[model samples]
Target: MGPSRHDQLTIGELSARSGLATSALRYYEELGLIHSERTAGGQRRFARQALRRVAFVRAAQRVGLSLEEAGAALAGLPVDRSPTATEWSRVARTWQSRIDEQIADLERLRDHLTGCIGCGCLSLGTCALYNPHDIQGTDGPGARKLLPRHSRTA
Candidate 1:
Protein backbone atom coordinates (compact mmCIF):
# COMPACT_ATOMS: atom_id res chain seq x y z
CA MET A 1 0.00 0.00 0.00
CA GLY A 2 0.95 3.64 -0.39
CA PRO A 3 0.87 6.37 2.26
CA SER A 4 -1.93 6.52 4.80
CA ARG A 5 -4.88 8.79 4.14
CA HIS A 6 -3.71 11.12 6.90
CA ASP A 7 -0.38 11.57 5.15
CA GLN A 8 0.46 14.33 2.74
CA LEU A 9 -2.11 15.14 0.03
CA THR A 10 -1.27 16.56 -3.36
CA ILE A 11 -2.62 19.93 -4.35
CA GLY A 12 -5.11 18.40 -6.78
CA GLU A 13 -6.25 15.98 -4.11
CA LEU A 14 -6.70 18.81 -1.62
CA SER A 15 -8.60 20.87 -4.14
CA ALA A 16 -10.84 17.97 -5.09
CA ARG A 17 -11.54 17.04 -1.49
CA SER A 18 -12.05 20.60 -0.34
CA GLY A 19 -14.24 21.50 -3.35
CA LEU A 20 -12.11 24.58 -4.02
CA ALA A 21 -10.48 25.24 -7.35
CA THR A 22 -6.74 24.96 -7.54
CA SER A 23 -6.50 28.70 -8.15
CA ALA A 24 -8.54 29.48 -5.07
CA LEU A 25 -6.42 27.12 -3.00
CA ARG A 26 -3.36 28.88 -4.32
CA TYR A 27 -4.89 32.20 -3.40
CA TYR A 28 -5.60 30.93 0.10
CA GLU A 29 -1.98 29.93 0.41
CA GLU A 30 -0.86 33.34 -0.81
CA LEU A 31 -3.06 34.98 1.80
CA GLY A 32 -1.47 32.81 4.54
CA LEU A 33 -4.79 31.18 5.27
CA ILE A 34 -3.32 27.75 4.57
CA HIS A 35 0.12 26.19 4.34
CA SER A 36 1.81 23.59 2.20
CA GLU A 37 5.18 22.13 1.33
CA ARG A 38 6.82 21.45 -1.97
CA THR A 39 7.76 17.99 -3.17
CA ALA A 40 11.18 17.13 -4.56
CA GLY A 41 9.62 17.76 -7.99
CA GLY A 42 8.46 21.23 -6.82
CA GLN A 43 4.84 20.09 -6.64
CA ARG A 44 2.66 21.35 -3.79
CA ARG A 45 1.70 18.95 -1.02
CA PHE A 46 -0.72 19.70 1.79
CA ALA A 47 -1.31 18.02 5.09
CA ARG A 48 -4.55 16.09 5.36
CA GLN A 49 -5.70 18.45 8.11
CA ALA A 50 -5.79 21.26 5.57
CA LEU A 51 -9.17 19.88 4.56
CA ARG A 52 -10.62 20.95 7.89
CA ARG A 53 -8.94 24.36 7.75
CA VAL A 54 -10.33 25.04 4.28
CA ALA A 55 -13.78 24.04 5.47
CA PHE A 56 -13.49 26.40 8.41
CA VAL A 57 -12.43 29.24 6.10
CA ARG A 58 -15.34 28.52 3.76
CA ALA A 59 -17.75 28.54 6.68
CA ALA A 60 -16.36 31.83 7.94
CA GLN A 61 -16.71 33.35 4.48
CA ARG A 62 -20.30 32.15 4.27
CA VAL A 63 -20.97 34.01 7.52
CA GLY A 64 -19.43 37.19 5.97
CA LEU A 65 -15.84 37.14 7.32
CA SER A 66 -13.12 38.31 4.96
CA LEU A 67 -10.16 36.11 4.14
CA GLU A 68 -8.05 38.47 6.23
CA GLU A 69 -10.16 37.75 9.28
CA ALA A 70 -9.90 34.04 8.74
CA GLY A 71 -6.19 34.35 8.23
CA ALA A 72 -5.90 36.29 11.46
CA ALA A 73 -7.75 33.55 13.26
CA LEU A 74 -5.24 31.05 11.96
CA ALA A 75 -2.24 33.26 12.58
CA GLY A 76 -1.77 32.27 16.18
CA LEU A 77 -1.12 28.68 15.35
CA PRO A 78 2.44 27.73 16.15
CA VAL A 79 4.71 27.52 13.18
CA ASP A 80 5.31 23.81 13.84
CA ARG A 81 1.81 22.97 15.05
CA SER A 82 -1.64 22.58 13.55
CA PRO A 83 -4.46 24.50 15.14
CA THR A 84 -5.90 22.92 18.23
CA ALA A 85 -9.61 22.42 18.80
CA THR A 86 -9.54 25.01 21.57
CA GLU A 87 -8.01 27.60 19.27
CA TRP A 88 -10.66 27.00 16.63
CA SER A 89 -13.38 27.25 19.25
CA ARG A 90 -11.99 30.59 20.37
CA VAL A 91 -12.04 31.90 16.83
CA ALA A 92 -15.62 30.74 16.35
CA ARG A 93 -16.70 32.43 19.56
CA THR A 94 -14.96 35.63 18.59
CA TRP A 95 -16.92 35.77 15.31
CA GLN A 96 -20.26 34.69 16.74
CA SER A 97 -21.44 38.26 17.31
CA ARG A 98 -20.25 39.28 13.87
CA ILE A 99 -22.25 36.47 12.31
CA ASP A 100 -25.28 37.46 14.36
CA GLU A 101 -24.88 41.07 13.28
CA GLN A 102 -24.75 39.99 9.64
CA ILE A 103 -27.93 37.97 10.05
CA ALA A 104 -29.64 40.92 11.72
CA ASP A 105 -28.53 43.23 8.90
CA LEU A 106 -29.85 40.81 6.30
CA GLU A 107 -33.13 40.51 8.12
CA ARG A 108 -33.47 44.26 8.37
CA LEU A 109 -32.63 44.70 4.68
CA ARG A 110 -35.10 42.01 3.69
CA ASP A 111 -37.83 43.61 5.76
CA HIS A 112 -37.08 46.97 4.21
CA LEU A 113 -37.27 45.56 0.70
CA THR A 114 -40.51 43.73 1.39
CA GLY A 115 -42.20 46.77 2.97
CA CYS A 116 -40.48 49.84 1.57
CA ILE A 117 -39.33 49.00 -1.94
CA GLY A 118 -42.29 46.71 -2.58
CA CYS A 119 -44.75 49.34 -1.48
CA GLY A 120 -46.73 50.41 -4.56
CA CYS A 121 -48.00 53.72 -3.17
CA LEU A 122 -47.69 56.57 -5.65
CA SER A 123 -46.15 59.20 -3.33
CA LEU A 124 -42.74 57.58 -3.09
CA GLY A 125 -40.95 60.82 -2.20
CA THR A 126 -43.05 61.54 0.88
CA CYS A 127 -42.94 58.05 2.39
CA ALA A 128 -43.17 57.70 6.20
CA LEU A 129 -40.10 55.44 6.23
CA TYR A 130 -37.84 58.38 5.61
CA ASN A 131 -36.77 60.91 8.22
CA PRO A 132 -39.23 59.83 10.88
CA HIS A 133 -39.45 62.45 13.66
CA ASP A 134 -37.29 64.70 11.46
CA ILE A 135 -34.20 63.07 13.01
CA GLN A 136 -32.76 62.73 9.51
CA GLY A 137 -32.44 58.99 9.37
CA THR A 138 -30.45 59.64 6.26
CA ASP A 139 -29.74 62.72 4.16
CA GLY A 140 -31.00 60.82 1.12
CA PRO A 141 -32.97 57.59 0.68
CA GLY A 142 -32.08 53.90 1.14
CA ALA A 143 -30.10 52.40 4.02
CA ARG A 144 -27.82 55.36 4.29
CA LYS A 145 -29.66 55.56 7.60
CA LEU A 146 -27.95 52.35 8.67
CA LEU A 147 -24.48 53.81 8.41
CA PRO A 148 -22.64 53.60 11.72
CA ARG A 149 -21.24 56.69 13.42
CA HIS A 150 -18.01 54.84 14.17
CA SER A 151 -15.27 53.37 12.04
CA ARG A 152 -15.61 49.85 10.53
CA THR A 153 -11.94 49.14 9.98
CA ALA A 154 -9.79 46.78 12.06
Candidate 2:
Protein backbone atom coordinates (compact mmCIF):
# COMPACT_ATOMS: atom_id res chain seq x y z
CA MET A 1 0.00 0.00 0.00
CA GLY A 2 1.02 3.61 -0.46
CA PRO A 3 2.20 5.57 2.53
CA SER A 4 -0.58 6.31 5.01
CA ARG A 5 -1.42 9.90 5.91
CA HIS A 6 0.29 9.29 9.21
CA ASP A 7 3.52 8.63 7.34
CA GLN A 8 3.40 12.02 5.70
CA LEU A 9 3.19 15.47 7.21
CA THR A 10 1.31 18.42 5.80
CA ILE A 11 3.38 21.53 5.09
CA GLY A 12 1.94 23.21 8.16
CA GLU A 13 2.76 20.24 10.35
CA LEU A 14 6.26 20.02 9.00
CA SER A 15 6.77 23.72 9.51
CA ALA A 16 5.59 23.50 13.10
CA ARG A 17 7.65 20.44 13.89
CA SER A 18 10.79 21.62 12.10
CA GLY A 19 10.63 25.13 13.52
CA LEU A 20 11.07 26.57 10.02
CA ALA A 21 8.73 28.90 8.24
CA THR A 22 6.59 27.38 5.52
CA SER A 23 8.24 29.79 3.07
CA ALA A 24 11.66 28.52 4.04
CA LEU A 25 10.44 24.95 3.59
CA ARG A 26 9.26 25.84 0.11
CA TYR A 27 12.62 27.43 -0.61
CA TYR A 28 14.41 24.35 0.62
CA GLU A 29 12.31 22.26 -1.75
CA GLU A 30 13.25 24.58 -4.56
CA LEU A 31 16.90 24.18 -3.67
CA GLY A 32 16.48 20.38 -3.65
CA LEU A 33 17.54 20.22 -0.02
CA ILE A 34 14.19 18.59 0.75
CA HIS A 35 11.39 17.02 -1.21
CA SER A 36 7.61 16.91 -0.98
CA GLU A 37 4.60 15.50 -2.72
CA ARG A 38 1.25 16.90 -3.63
CA THR A 39 -2.03 15.74 -2.18
CA ALA A 40 -5.24 15.39 -4.18
CA GLY A 41 -6.01 18.99 -3.22
CA GLY A 42 -2.54 20.03 -4.47
CA GLN A 43 -1.24 20.87 -1.05
CA ARG A 44 2.37 19.91 -0.29
CA ARG A 45 2.93 16.95 1.94
CA PHE A 46 6.34 15.89 3.20
CA ALA A 47 7.53 12.50 4.28
CA ARG A 48 8.45 12.21 7.93
CA GLN A 49 12.02 11.76 6.79
CA ALA A 50 11.98 15.41 5.78
CA LEU A 51 12.24 16.31 9.44
CA ARG A 52 15.59 14.55 9.65
CA ARG A 53 16.72 16.16 6.43
CA VAL A 54 15.71 19.60 7.68
CA ALA A 55 17.62 19.02 10.89
CA PHE A 56 20.66 17.94 8.93
CA VAL A 57 20.54 21.05 6.78
CA ARG A 58 20.27 23.25 9.88
CA ALA A 59 23.28 21.53 11.44
CA ALA A 60 25.26 22.05 8.26
CA GLN A 61 24.39 25.73 8.29
CA ARG A 62 25.54 26.02 11.89
CA VAL A 63 28.90 24.67 10.76
CA GLY A 64 29.02 27.39 8.08
CA LEU A 65 28.16 25.24 5.03
CA SER A 66 26.36 27.09 2.29
CA LEU A 67 22.95 25.82 1.24
CA GLU A 68 24.57 24.54 -1.93
CA GLU A 69 27.12 22.61 0.09
CA ALA A 70 24.40 21.22 2.36
CA GLY A 71 22.36 20.20 -0.67
CA ALA A 72 25.35 18.41 -2.13
CA ALA A 73 25.88 16.57 1.13
CA LEU A 74 22.22 15.59 1.28
CA ALA A 75 22.40 14.38 -2.32
CA GLY A 76 25.03 11.89 -1.24
CA LEU A 77 22.56 10.16 1.02
CA PRO A 78 20.34 7.33 -0.18
CA VAL A 79 17.19 8.78 -1.66
CA ASP A 80 15.20 5.67 -0.94
CA ARG A 81 15.68 5.94 2.79
CA SER A 82 17.31 7.87 5.60
CA PRO A 83 21.05 7.58 5.86
CA THR A 84 22.71 5.16 8.23
CA ALA A 85 25.13 6.37 10.86
CA THR A 86 28.07 5.29 8.72
CA GLU A 87 26.68 7.10 5.68
CA TRP A 88 26.14 10.28 7.65
CA SER A 89 29.68 10.08 9.02
CA ARG A 90 31.13 9.62 5.55
CA VAL A 91 29.51 12.77 4.21
CA ALA A 92 30.25 14.80 7.35
CA ARG A 93 33.95 13.92 7.18
CA THR A 94 34.31 15.85 3.93
CA TRP A 95 33.42 19.06 5.75
CA GLN A 96 36.02 18.72 8.52
CA SER A 97 38.72 20.65 6.69
CA ARG A 98 36.25 23.34 5.63
CA ILE A 99 35.10 23.82 9.22
CA ASP A 100 38.71 23.93 10.35
CA GLU A 101 39.48 26.62 7.80
CA GLN A 102 36.54 28.68 9.05
CA ILE A 103 37.82 28.31 12.60
CA ALA A 104 41.27 29.47 11.51
CA ASP A 105 39.78 32.43 9.67
CA LEU A 106 37.76 33.44 12.76
CA GLU A 107 40.84 33.20 14.94
CA ARG A 108 42.84 35.25 12.44
CA LEU A 109 40.14 37.93 12.35
CA ARG A 110 39.99 38.05 16.14
CA ASP A 111 43.76 38.43 16.41
CA HIS A 112 43.87 41.15 13.76
CA LEU A 113 40.71 43.04 14.73
CA THR A 114 42.72 45.62 16.66
CA GLY A 115 45.18 46.23 13.84
CA CYS A 116 45.10 47.64 10.32
CA ILE A 117 42.95 45.67 7.83
CA GLY A 118 44.95 46.88 4.85
CA CYS A 119 41.82 47.63 2.83
CA GLY A 120 43.41 50.89 1.69
CA CYS A 121 40.89 52.63 3.94
CA LEU A 122 43.76 54.24 5.86
CA SER A 123 41.23 55.04 8.56
CA LEU A 124 43.55 54.09 11.38
CA GLY A 125 46.55 56.30 12.05
CA THR A 126 48.67 53.13 12.09
CA CYS A 127 47.69 52.48 8.45
CA ALA A 128 50.35 55.06 7.52
CA LEU A 129 53.02 52.59 8.61
CA TYR A 130 51.45 49.31 7.51
CA ASN A 131 49.81 50.42 4.27
CA PRO A 132 52.01 53.43 3.55
CA HIS A 133 49.90 55.76 1.38
CA ASP A 134 47.44 53.02 0.45
CA ILE A 135 50.16 51.06 -1.34
CA GLN A 136 48.26 47.83 -0.61
CA GLY A 137 45.62 49.10 -3.04
CA THR A 138 48.11 48.29 -5.80
CA ASP A 139 47.49 44.59 -5.18
CA GLY A 140 43.70 44.57 -5.63
CA PRO A 141 40.37 45.58 -4.19
CA GLY A 142 39.08 44.35 -0.81
CA ALA A 143 40.96 43.96 2.44
CA ARG A 144 44.20 42.78 0.92
CA LYS A 145 46.16 42.07 4.06
CA LEU A 146 43.17 40.96 6.14
CA LEU A 147 41.97 38.45 3.58
CA PRO A 148 42.90 34.80 4.00
CA ARG A 149 46.40 34.09 2.77
CA HIS A 150 45.15 31.62 0.17
CA SER A 151 42.80 34.32 -1.21
CA ARG A 152 45.55 36.91 -1.69
CA THR A 153 46.70 36.87 -5.30
CA ALA A 154 49.77 39.05 -4.99
Candidate 3:
Protein backbone atom coordinates (compact mmCIF):
# COMPACT_ATOMS: atom_id res chain seq x y z
CA MET A 1 0.00 0.00 0.00
CA GLY A 2 1.36 3.38 -1.02
CA PRO A 3 1.46 5.75 1.99
CA SER A 4 -1.47 3.87 3.66
CA ARG A 5 -4.14 5.82 1.73
CA HIS A 6 -5.49 8.15 4.41
CA ASP A 7 -7.71 10.09 2.05
CA GLN A 8 -11.05 9.38 3.67
CA LEU A 9 -12.56 8.52 7.03
CA THR A 10 -15.89 6.99 7.94
CA ILE A 11 -18.34 9.29 9.71
CA GLY A 12 -17.76 7.57 13.06
CA GLU A 13 -14.00 7.93 12.74
CA LEU A 14 -14.39 11.56 11.73
CA SER A 15 -16.56 12.21 14.73
CA ALA A 16 -14.06 10.66 17.12
CA ARG A 17 -11.09 12.47 15.62
CA SER A 18 -12.86 15.82 15.43
CA GLY A 19 -14.47 15.57 18.85
CA LEU A 20 -17.89 16.32 17.42
CA ALA A 21 -21.02 14.25 17.59
CA THR A 22 -22.06 12.44 14.46
CA SER A 23 -25.37 14.30 14.48
CA ALA A 24 -23.61 17.65 14.48
CA LEU A 25 -21.48 16.52 11.57
CA ARG A 26 -24.62 15.53 9.74
CA TYR A 27 -26.22 18.85 10.58
CA TYR A 28 -23.18 20.68 9.29
CA GLU A 29 -23.37 18.73 6.08
CA GLU A 30 -27.05 19.52 5.77
CA LEU A 31 -26.30 23.20 6.29
CA GLY A 32 -23.72 23.13 3.51
CA LEU A 33 -20.95 23.69 6.03
CA ILE A 34 -19.23 20.38 5.20
CA HIS A 35 -19.24 17.71 2.55
CA SER A 36 -19.14 13.97 2.44
CA GLU A 37 -19.44 11.08 0.06
CA ARG A 38 -21.50 7.92 0.42
CA THR A 39 -20.14 4.43 0.40
CA ALA A 40 -21.77 1.49 -1.34
CA GLY A 41 -23.57 0.87 1.93
CA GLY A 42 -24.75 4.50 1.95
CA GLN A 43 -22.65 5.50 4.92
CA ARG A 44 -21.03 8.91 4.94
CA ARG A 45 -17.34 9.21 4.30
CA PHE A 46 -15.57 12.49 4.88
CA ALA A 47 -12.20 13.76 3.83
CA ARG A 48 -9.56 13.84 6.55
CA GLN A 49 -9.33 17.61 6.10
CA ALA A 50 -12.81 17.79 7.56
CA LEU A 51 -11.25 17.43 11.01
CA ARG A 52 -9.74 20.90 10.82
CA ARG A 53 -12.87 22.28 9.23
CA VAL A 54 -15.01 20.97 12.08
CA ALA A 55 -12.62 22.46 14.64
CA PHE A 56 -12.78 25.81 12.90
CA VAL A 57 -16.57 25.78 12.91
CA ARG A 58 -16.67 25.01 16.63
CA ALA A 59 -14.16 27.77 17.36
CA ALA A 60 -16.21 30.25 15.34
CA GLN A 61 -19.31 29.33 17.32
CA ARG A 62 -17.37 29.81 20.56
CA VAL A 63 -16.65 33.36 19.38
CA GLY A 64 -20.42 33.92 18.96
CA LEU A 65 -20.61 33.83 15.19
CA SER A 66 -23.92 32.42 13.96
CA LEU A 67 -23.82 29.32 11.84
CA GLU A 68 -24.72 31.28 8.70
CA GLU A 69 -21.76 33.61 9.16
CA ALA A 70 -19.49 30.70 9.93
CA GLY A 71 -20.66 28.93 6.79
CA ALA A 72 -19.95 32.00 4.69
CA ALA A 73 -16.52 32.38 6.21
CA LEU A 74 -15.72 28.74 5.65
CA ALA A 75 -17.02 28.87 2.10
CA GLY A 76 -13.86 30.61 1.01
CA LEU A 77 -11.98 27.42 1.63
CA PRO A 78 -11.28 25.16 -1.32
CA VAL A 79 -13.14 21.88 -0.99
CA ASP A 80 -10.66 20.05 -3.18
CA ARG A 81 -7.87 20.51 -0.64
CA SER A 82 -7.31 21.29 3.02
CA PRO A 83 -6.98 24.93 3.94
CA THR A 84 -3.57 26.55 4.36
CA ALA A 85 -2.62 29.02 7.09
CA THR A 86 -2.97 31.87 4.62
CA GLU A 87 -6.46 30.72 3.69
CA TRP A 88 -7.47 30.39 7.32
CA SER A 89 -6.07 33.87 8.02
CA ARG A 90 -8.06 35.31 5.16
CA VAL A 91 -11.22 33.76 6.59
CA ALA A 92 -10.42 34.98 10.09
CA ARG A 93 -9.85 38.54 8.87
CA THR A 94 -13.42 38.58 7.60
CA TRP A 95 -14.65 38.22 11.17
CA GLN A 96 -12.68 41.21 12.53
CA SER A 97 -15.47 43.67 11.90
CA ARG A 98 -18.11 41.40 13.41
CA ILE A 99 -15.98 40.88 16.52
CA ASP A 100 -15.41 44.61 16.84
CA GLU A 101 -19.08 45.34 16.50
CA GLN A 102 -19.98 42.76 19.12
CA ILE A 103 -17.41 44.23 21.51
CA ALA A 104 -18.74 47.73 21.01
CA ASP A 105 -22.31 46.57 21.55
CA LEU A 106 -21.34 44.71 24.72
CA GLU A 107 -19.54 47.78 26.07
CA ARG A 108 -22.51 49.98 25.34
CA LEU A 109 -24.88 47.56 27.04
CA ARG A 110 -22.56 47.32 30.05
CA ASP A 111 -22.38 51.05 30.42
CA HIS A 112 -26.12 51.40 30.07
CA LEU A 113 -26.77 48.81 32.75
CA THR A 114 -24.27 50.35 35.15
CA GLY A 115 -25.53 53.89 34.57
CA CYS A 116 -29.16 52.93 35.02
CA ILE A 117 -28.81 50.85 38.18
CA GLY A 118 -28.58 53.91 40.43
CA CYS A 119 -30.58 56.32 38.34
CA GLY A 120 -34.01 57.59 39.40
CA CYS A 121 -35.20 56.87 35.85
CA LEU A 122 -36.09 53.37 37.02
CA SER A 123 -38.90 54.88 39.11
CA LEU A 124 -40.55 56.75 36.23
CA GLY A 125 -42.62 54.92 33.68
CA THR A 126 -41.89 57.69 31.18
CA CYS A 127 -38.15 57.31 31.52
CA ALA A 128 -36.38 55.95 28.46
CA LEU A 129 -35.01 53.06 30.45
CA TYR A 130 -38.46 52.08 31.57
CA ASN A 131 -40.39 52.97 28.43
CA PRO A 132 -40.44 50.28 25.77
CA HIS A 133 -40.75 52.79 22.93
CA ASP A 134 -37.83 54.85 24.19
CA ILE A 135 -35.33 52.07 24.75
CA GLN A 136 -36.34 49.49 22.18
CA GLY A 137 -35.15 51.37 19.12
CA THR A 138 -31.88 52.67 20.49
CA ASP A 139 -29.60 49.66 20.15
CA GLY A 140 -28.20 47.10 17.74
CA PRO A 141 -30.71 44.43 16.67
CA GLY A 142 -33.67 46.53 17.73
CA ALA A 143 -32.34 49.87 16.48
CA ARG A 144 -35.21 49.91 14.01
CA LYS A 145 -38.77 49.12 14.90
CA LEU A 146 -40.29 45.90 13.56
CA LEU A 147 -37.05 44.03 13.24
CA PRO A 148 -37.43 40.76 11.37
CA ARG A 149 -37.28 38.64 14.47
CA HIS A 150 -39.58 40.99 16.32
CA SER A 151 -42.23 41.48 13.69
CA ARG A 152 -45.81 41.77 14.86
CA THR A 153 -48.80 40.47 12.95
CA ALA A 154 -52.33 41.70 12.84
Candidate 4:
Protein backbone atom coordinates (compact mmCIF):
# COMPACT_ATOMS: atom_id res chain seq x y z
CA MET A 1 0.00 0.00 0.00
CA GLY A 2 1.08 3.57 -0.57
CA PRO A 3 2.01 5.85 2.27
CA SER A 4 -0.93 7.08 4.26
CA ARG A 5 -1.59 10.56 5.62
CA HIS A 6 0.09 9.52 8.84
CA ASP A 7 3.24 8.69 6.88
CA GLN A 8 4.49 12.02 5.60
CA LEU A 9 6.90 12.24 2.67
CA THR A 10 10.24 13.98 2.73
CA ILE A 11 10.85 16.96 0.42
CA GLY A 12 12.75 14.81 -2.04
CA GLU A 13 9.96 12.27 -2.22
CA LEU A 14 7.42 14.99 -2.88
CA SER A 15 9.61 16.47 -5.61
CA ALA A 16 10.14 13.08 -7.28
CA ARG A 17 6.48 12.15 -7.22
CA SER A 18 5.25 15.59 -8.28
CA GLY A 19 7.83 16.13 -11.05
CA LEU A 20 8.83 19.47 -9.51
CA ALA A 21 12.41 20.24 -8.52
CA THR A 22 13.12 20.33 -4.80
CA SER A 23 13.78 24.07 -5.06
CA ALA A 24 10.44 24.64 -6.83
CA LEU A 25 8.64 22.77 -4.08
CA ARG A 26 10.35 24.93 -1.48
CA TYR A 27 9.38 28.05 -3.47
CA TYR A 28 5.78 26.84 -3.53
CA GLU A 29 5.83 26.59 0.23
CA GLU A 30 7.34 30.05 0.49
CA LEU A 31 4.56 31.40 -1.73
CA GLY A 32 2.02 29.72 0.58
CA LEU A 33 0.68 27.66 -2.29
CA ILE A 34 1.60 24.51 -0.37
CA HIS A 35 2.52 23.81 3.22
CA SER A 36 4.71 21.24 4.96
CA GLU A 37 5.16 19.99 8.47
CA ARG A 38 8.45 20.52 10.18
CA THR A 39 10.57 17.71 11.61
CA ALA A 40 12.37 18.04 14.90
CA GLY A 41 15.59 18.41 12.92
CA GLY A 42 14.04 21.31 10.99
CA GLN A 43 13.65 19.32 7.77
CA ARG A 44 10.44 19.50 5.74
CA ARG A 45 7.88 16.69 5.74
CA PHE A 46 4.95 16.87 3.31
CA ALA A 47 1.68 15.11 3.88
CA ARG A 48 0.60 12.75 1.10
CA GLN A 49 -2.13 15.28 0.36
CA ALA A 50 0.62 17.62 -0.80
CA LEU A 51 0.94 15.62 -4.00
CA ARG A 52 -2.55 16.71 -4.95
CA ARG A 53 -1.60 20.32 -4.16
CA VAL A 54 1.44 20.07 -6.40
CA ALA A 55 -0.70 18.65 -9.19
CA PHE A 56 -3.09 21.55 -8.82
CA VAL A 57 -0.22 24.04 -8.95
CA ARG A 58 1.19 22.46 -12.10
CA ALA A 59 -2.20 22.38 -13.77
CA ALA A 60 -2.78 26.01 -12.90
CA GLN A 61 0.58 26.86 -14.44
CA ARG A 62 -0.32 24.96 -17.60
CA VAL A 63 -3.39 27.18 -17.85
CA GLY A 64 -1.10 30.28 -17.67
CA LEU A 65 -1.74 31.29 -14.08
CA SER A 66 1.02 33.06 -12.22
CA LEU A 67 2.28 31.55 -8.97
CA GLU A 68 0.38 34.17 -7.02
CA GLU A 69 -2.82 33.33 -8.88
CA ALA A 70 -2.29 29.61 -8.22
CA GLY A 71 -1.77 30.39 -4.56
CA ALA A 72 -5.08 32.28 -4.49
CA ALA A 73 -6.88 29.30 -5.97
CA LEU A 74 -5.24 26.89 -3.55
CA ALA A 75 -6.09 29.15 -0.67
CA GLY A 76 -9.76 28.31 -1.12
CA LEU A 77 -9.05 24.83 0.17
CA PRO A 78 -8.96 24.22 3.88
CA VAL A 79 -5.41 23.93 5.10
CA ASP A 80 -6.29 21.38 7.80
CA ARG A 81 -8.00 18.96 5.39
CA SER A 82 -7.32 17.44 2.00
CA PRO A 83 -9.10 18.92 -1.01
CA THR A 84 -12.20 17.07 -2.20
CA ALA A 85 -13.33 16.51 -5.79
CA THR A 86 -16.14 19.03 -5.46
CA GLU A 87 -13.73 21.63 -4.12
CA TRP A 88 -11.33 21.02 -6.99
CA SER A 89 -14.16 21.34 -9.50
CA ARG A 90 -15.23 24.66 -8.08
CA VAL A 91 -11.73 26.04 -8.07
CA ALA A 92 -10.89 24.79 -11.55
CA ARG A 93 -14.07 26.29 -12.97
CA THR A 94 -12.84 29.75 -12.11
CA TRP A 95 -10.15 29.32 -14.77
CA GLN A 96 -12.63 28.66 -17.58
CA SER A 97 -13.16 32.32 -18.47
CA ARG A 98 -9.46 32.98 -18.43
CA ILE A 99 -8.87 29.98 -20.67
CA ASP A 100 -11.63 30.99 -23.07
CA GLU A 101 -10.26 34.51 -23.39
CA GLN A 102 -6.84 33.09 -24.17
CA ILE A 103 -8.37 30.80 -26.79
CA ALA A 104 -10.16 33.68 -28.45
CA ASP A 105 -6.96 35.72 -28.48
CA LEU A 106 -5.09 32.83 -30.08
CA GLU A 107 -7.76 32.35 -32.72
CA ARG A 108 -7.62 36.00 -33.67
CA LEU A 109 -3.83 35.96 -33.96
CA ARG A 110 -3.84 32.78 -36.05
CA ASP A 111 -6.48 34.08 -38.44
CA HIS A 112 -4.70 37.38 -39.03
CA LEU A 113 -1.15 36.02 -39.19
CA THR A 114 0.74 36.28 -42.53
CA GLY A 115 -1.85 38.71 -43.86
CA CYS A 116 -1.18 42.41 -44.60
CA ILE A 117 -2.35 43.90 -41.28
CA GLY A 118 -2.02 47.66 -41.85
CA CYS A 119 -2.15 48.03 -45.60
CA GLY A 120 -4.70 46.46 -47.91
CA CYS A 121 -2.54 44.69 -50.49
CA LEU A 122 -1.83 41.32 -52.03
CA SER A 123 1.98 41.73 -51.78
CA LEU A 124 4.52 42.03 -48.92
CA GLY A 125 7.15 44.53 -50.25
CA THR A 126 4.58 47.34 -50.63
CA CYS A 127 3.37 46.70 -47.09
CA ALA A 128 5.05 49.05 -44.61
CA LEU A 129 5.59 46.21 -42.17
CA TYR A 130 7.56 44.29 -44.78
CA ASN A 131 9.58 47.35 -45.82
CA PRO A 132 12.02 48.12 -43.03
CA HIS A 133 12.47 51.73 -44.22
CA ASP A 134 8.68 52.34 -44.04
CA ILE A 135 7.37 54.66 -41.28
CA GLN A 136 5.58 51.84 -39.44
CA GLY A 137 8.71 49.69 -39.72
CA THR A 138 10.57 52.33 -37.74
CA ASP A 139 9.00 50.90 -34.59
CA GLY A 140 10.86 47.60 -35.13
CA PRO A 141 10.10 44.13 -36.47
CA GLY A 142 7.35 41.86 -35.12
CA ALA A 143 3.55 42.02 -35.18
CA ARG A 144 3.36 45.38 -33.45
CA LYS A 145 -0.27 46.28 -34.06
CA LEU A 146 -1.35 42.66 -34.21
CA LEU A 147 -2.39 43.00 -30.62
CA PRO A 148 -6.05 43.46 -29.72
CA ARG A 149 -7.51 46.78 -30.87
CA HIS A 150 -7.72 48.23 -27.38
CA SER A 151 -4.28 46.95 -26.52
CA ARG A 152 -2.60 48.27 -29.66
CA THR A 153 -0.86 51.67 -29.50
CA ALA A 154 0.98 53.77 -32.07
lDDT of 1: 0.72
Residues 27-143 of candidate 2: C-alpha lDDT, one tens digit per residue:
999999889999889999899999999998999998899999999888888866878899978977877878999898777656555455546444322343333435334444433
Model 1: CA > 4 A from native: 1-6, 77-85, 117-154
Q: Candidate 2 at 126: error in angstroms? A: 8.7
lDDT of 2: 0.78
lDDT for each of the candidates? 0.72, 0.78, 0.73, 0.74
Per-residue CA lDDT of candidate 1, range 1-154, in tens? 9556469888899999999999999999999878888877899888877887898789888868899987776676544456678876777787898888988877865665566576644232333443232333345645446444552333
| Models, CA RMSD each | 8.4, 7.0, 6.3, 7.9
Model 3, range 12-97, lDDT digits (tens) per residue?
Answer: 89888888899999999999888988878898888777887888799888778988878887888876677789997887776777
Residue 20's lDDT in candidate 3 = 89
Highest TM-score, which number?
Answer: 2
Q: Which ten residues in a row have the lowest lDDT in candidate 3?
A: 123-132
Order of the predicted models by TM-score, top scorer first = 2, 3, 4, 1
Q: Per-prediction TM-score, please?
A: 0.66, 0.75, 0.70, 0.68
Model 1 TM-score, 2 decimals: 0.66
Report model 4's TM-score to 2 decimal places: 0.68
Rank the models by lDDT, top first: 2, 4, 3, 1
